[model samples]
Target chain A: MMRITRDSLLSGNANRRSWMALVNPSASELTQAAATLDIPESFLRKRLEGEASRPLIKQERLISLQFQVPMPKKGGTGQFMLVPLSLYFVPGYFVTLSEQEIPFLSQLIDPQKPRKRWELVLRIIAEVTRNYLPTARSVAREMAVVERDLRQAQRHDVVYRGLDINDRLLTLDLGLLQLEYVVSEIGHFLPAEDAVLAEIHEDTRIELSQVRDQVDSDQATINELLESYAYVVHNNVNHLFKFMAALIILATIPLFIPGAVAMNVPLGNFPHWHYGFTVVTGGLVLVEMLTAWVFYRKGWLRLD
Target chain B: MGCQFYDTVEDVWVATERYTADGLFLLMPEQVHQCPQLEAALQRCLEQRLYCQDAEITLRLPVALLAQDAQFGTVGRMTHLTLHHTPRSLAILGEEPLIRRLQQNWLGELRHTSMGELLQRVLLSIIYSHERVARVLVERLQVLRMALKTAMGNTELRQIVALNRDLGELVIALRETGLILRNALRATPGESPVYPLLDAALREQRRIEDGVNLIHERYLAVTNAYNGIVQNNAHTVMKVMTVWLALLMMPIAFIMPWHMMTPLPLEHWHYLWFGLLAYVFGVTLLFARWARKHGFFSM
Candidate 1:
């Protein structure tokens, strides 16, 4: 709900403690921002596009991080976006740059709960980790819903929804994989040379590792259930195939008898007789009945 | 040769090979030291000429023949290995090969020969109250793989797939290990598929067969049921269609020849005969079709 513009982020009010900035940077602005900051142009470009950033890299006292933050719970589609955040710790000041507004900063800047910048980053990562479980559960529930629709044979709408669910599941799986990959990269920065930094980094490492593990576990569970559902879909397709095949084979039987009769292989001059045509017709009727009865017994037809 | 049984553990059969210098004693776990019965059984294997010749040097001899008192705890279960001894080195060459060949040949006769042999061996070790029996079984990895295969999957198809993959791994591992064991023993004491291992192989084979049967039955029943339902519906449809055509076509026959005969025998009558007949035939045909469509007499 909070929409922060570029003007708000650059607002020159020293007194204001907290603010939200939505920075929908155009391609040129992003390029210019990278030029002014002297960072690689790809840094901002990459994060802005993907669901999550690849990993954090530190060069020349500047740390650039990419994160895939989950949208709000009520956010339609439950998608996450890739946002690249770069931090500069140049002696006098610190700066955060992102293509979009960062919500975590607002929580840190809240008047009642003032937090140091270092504490805020840890808090942000922790909150992101905790939120993954619920988001994953929602995806699982969505899959179950699709599975139920399949069971009910609701092919009309669910065919599309099933496709959507499959796509969503792929998206979620990729997002989690990227998140874990980034966390593992960040983990390498731990065992800090400085004591305080080490303590903080180690604790964060454990938290992130646990989150990575939990997400991986959930990913596996979702995949297994999806495989089972795949089998169900396969079974349904086979059922439909059997039905169609039976119908085709059944309908073909009547055609064969008519074809033989039309061949006009003489049946004792019955065709020339006045009402002898009735006998031929009667024979045709008898043939159809007998063929149908055989078909019925052979289980090509179902009265039940 | 006479068979001598040194019944140490209740379910276990132990044979001790005789040493020419002094009788060799098979060392058991420390817990058995407390059980006077197992101690007495160990003495019986040494005293009676019951030990196989190859068993003499291979059996782990105690710290001292008299045995000092020590508290012992075990890391895991123990698998009882048969040891053989011979009076001379020549006796060994002849006896060991015969023992090896006998064990190897017996495997072919055993009704089942997969993990059943391994399971039976493990179970026997457990029933004999051998220490580290579970660990010994676990070390093989094949048993655990087979157990996991059986443990998972609810539906017959899923279970069959799971079990097949597991059993495939198990069989491959066993074959590879058997080759490794044979190569290792070719230089020394030698190896064979003894009775116990053969028994376990049979047990696992049975499990595989059961899984296969379950999957077959499940597939057959579902297909049969589905076919029955579809067939019955089609028969009812065909019967009604046949009856419909017969009723509808009956009226066209009665009017066809009567109209044609009356108009013939004159030049105009010749054309009129064919033409009138055709007109009546067309009208009758249309009426019959309409009746058939409305189901006036169909079925």
Candidate 2:
């Protein structure tokens, strides 16, 4: 599933030159893009495969930038997955290659709008930085859900949910940190001559820093919630064990008297004397009542 | 064809199907074909409307368009809307008052702002509308949680289920809208005035999303608690029934023995019936005590 789309710089017909966006490119498509854009096939391949040794901005014959963007995966557990996107700045046009369809890229480079090559590049970086906000926001929401669930009940399912959210928050935090560093590096790579690029870099830096702050705050919140949930679950289990022990102690007290009476153990006066059944039964009744009253007053007989 | 005009003093544009005594009339959707620019703007507006039904600003260079719909009144609501912005000229389409409000609230206040800034304000307003609804839902969730703590009937459970459904829908809608807005903000220039506002709005939207998700979690918890309460109630009923059965059967242990003719020892006694009565009473009392001690009557 690969798509190559050509977007024009402006809407008018006179100066409608096209830039290429390759979505989920195949090997042959990558080679074609490399040949047409005069970029090295290896550079294109490495970026698509996300095999870059480090985030870099190189200007040999053609300018190239390798950065990562967080892509969402479809699942209930809410995970943060990052994918690398490589950009090649060819003469009179720009090319973007990614293993997956980056929807925000298409939005940034609208065919109907007129944008310079540098403007498009800057927009792409800005958009990629903003993309983290939504995913981070989602993770925060999932954390809140887990926190609420823990408040309602300390069940294993809820505990697992808290752990799951914690994992997500950690993944998001790592991604955001890496992105912040990449963005900073990109800012330094921009030429000092272009004031527009400099301004864009500053704005992007600010936005990225804000995003990092938000991620850190959310991570802190999720960590706190998970710790509290663990403590609550442990306390609940201890209480349950104590309640069961009390129940066992109270239940065993009556079994002894009943067993002795049924076995016909002749202690004082049994069936050999008149009213023997009455005297024996009455004595057992008094003992049972007194034991129960004592246990009740001591709070061991409480069911709730 | 109706008369169309712009209020130069108020900087408001009016478009209507019929000539009005006070306002002006602009070109309808069908009449703007001659000017290719206006036609293109209308086409873009229509495309945006396909996804977002409310007010939106779609900026295409050489022209920027604003479309809004106002749903007023209670039953059979009447909607009046207008679309316009300042670029080459004030090209206003649709109703007048909607355009005026857009001018005074968004465009006029943000005159020095970039298109991205104006668009961000619009998007934030839309997102905040959902936030308000989410706040109400969170409050309702708290009420439901309180109710479930004591007793949860079928009605309350049904309400929780309904609320869950609503929250699911709300979350989906908000997420989709948020994604769209984020993409839009990204496409704009980084130096756009909306950048800071975008950060704040995104933060607010995140908070709302968190609130909704929390409510949903609480709803599930309350439901599970309700089921536990029901099961506990059933167990209590069974426990009481078992105690009663034990009490009723206690006398049968002694009564069955007396039916035998071999019981001749106590038969000659004068107070044999009284002794049997006392024995039965003592055994019943003992059985009750044992039952009580075992938590049969604890609840």
Candidate 3:
């Protein structure tokens, strides 16, 4: 539970973060219905009446930065989503506005007097994004399983899982892009001479950059998995069709022999001869066996 | 009431009282925790656990006072000592009882010669406190390992989950404290009276951090390897069932159509039903062999 001026450095283990703030139950602590800023009032509304994905907007004396941080989907979906968390430095107070309380905000330096607000902000951004690393590792494990028994991916249940992964990966990528943009802009507000703050800034930048690279790598792996998944499914269906075609052709060729025997213009008296039906039937069975053997030898009878 | 120093000449803790007037003061402000205004400002800090594990040193600048704070204590006790250094004086603020105890227990290891060396020893004591906790964590890990060997229910699994959470917190605390000590090492001047002391503090932090990390890695390995064996056994059973059903499907596919139409020789014979049954088994055997040869029906 030890926190410091550099919570970001301490957040190296994003799993055990201390989140005792637990999200205020009242929830409307930052209800700014009427502020003195020239910007749109909708921006201050709790509903966040403007663009949901806005990265940062500094207008006059108010600087508001909005970012999408990843969170697990509710209802035990086993899927992750990007939720918007907005930080506003308006007048004397630094308020963060999120639909639900993100645990990362608890690590912010005393919000009432955040003399080190920039450090906390950068750290929060870095920590929330870095949390995705563990999730990504799990996702890679899932991808490995799907890759091995890829034919099973075509099942109704597993099919949607692939889509869910794709959705989660895209959401992560979008969140990271906003973070990348926000951190670059955050550098301008840093006090020029404080070596400690500079060091923190550099660390945050490196952490975010690494996360971005990881997202890219994960994105590539998933895309490759999906492509292989498609090819396996496609090849299975095509092979099944080929095997059915061979079955049909083998079944049909023997029927022509019986048809030939019943021809009206047969001069050989095949129909009039004794035991003519048995000979024609026996010849038909022979033709069917030969055709099936040919198809099996050609490997067209196998769908596996 | 401050500035108790370890006297090099007398080889004792000296209560000279002159160092207080000399602008070097160790100020323990228990009242800061009580102040209403400061309470709101310290809310973020108060949200952390009462026990102090992560230590951070901040220098209040030329434009501001440089404050370096570290905490030292055992259970039911802790002190958040902030070393606020300014040109006028240096103040150490925290709970008074701990401050008094460090002075009372002093064995002339600290110095008034340089505040850096004193601060270094203060941090070394904090890191030293964690060694006991690490020992407890490692012992619990061993228990969890033994429990998993004869694991009959979810009891050991829950214990593992709980132990992992504890390991994670300890790791974060150790690493953060290590980084703080490392920073102290970098910032202290080699020619200064505190450099070697700072180095010793960093070394102590590293030893603890590395030791805790070894435990963490062992915990992870134990849990992961256990989970893998469980999963692999489960998968093997599932694979065997799936292969059995899949192998039956091949025979079923080829025989069902033939059974629907084909007329066997001596159709009225009493053994005719046996022939059909034998045919089904014969085809199944051949397909199973083929599957085995193709490496498709591995157990």
Q: On residues B1-299, what C-alpha lDDT tens digit does candidate 1 reach at each position?
A: 21212232342324543322222223223333443533443444445313323322211111100112132111221122333332211111112333333234221222222333322332222222211222222232223222332232323233333333333333333333333223323423434334323333333333323323332222222322222223322332443454444433433433333322122224256576576666656765775576455332322
RMSD of 2: 19.0
DockQ of 2: 0.01
Instruction: List the candidates' TM-scores in order.
Output: 0.38, 0.46, 0.43
Clash-forming residue pairs, model 3: B27-B92, B59-B66, B60-B65, B60-B66, B60-B67
Candidate 1 structure quality by residue, lDDT tens digits, A212-255: 56544554454445434445544543443443344444444434
Which regions of candidate 3 deviate over 4 angstroms? A1-41, A50-54, A75-78, A107-115, A137-149, A152-164, A224-228, A264-282, B1-299
**Lowest lDDT 10-mer window, candidate 2 chain B?**
B71-80
* Model 1, position B164: C-alpha lDDT score: 37
Worst 10 residues of 1 chain B by lDDT: B58-67
- Estimate, for each residue in A76-160, the C-alpha lDDT of model 2 and write its tens digit: 4356677777776665456777777888776777777757565566677778778788888887787667656554342344555
RMSD of each: 22.3, 19.0, 22.5
lDDT of 3 by residue, A123-215 (tens): 787787677666665555666555666553222223335545654665566566667768877888777886887888888888888876886
Return the TM-scores of chain A for each candidate in numbered order: 0.58, 0.78, 0.73
Candidate 3: what lDDT? 0.52
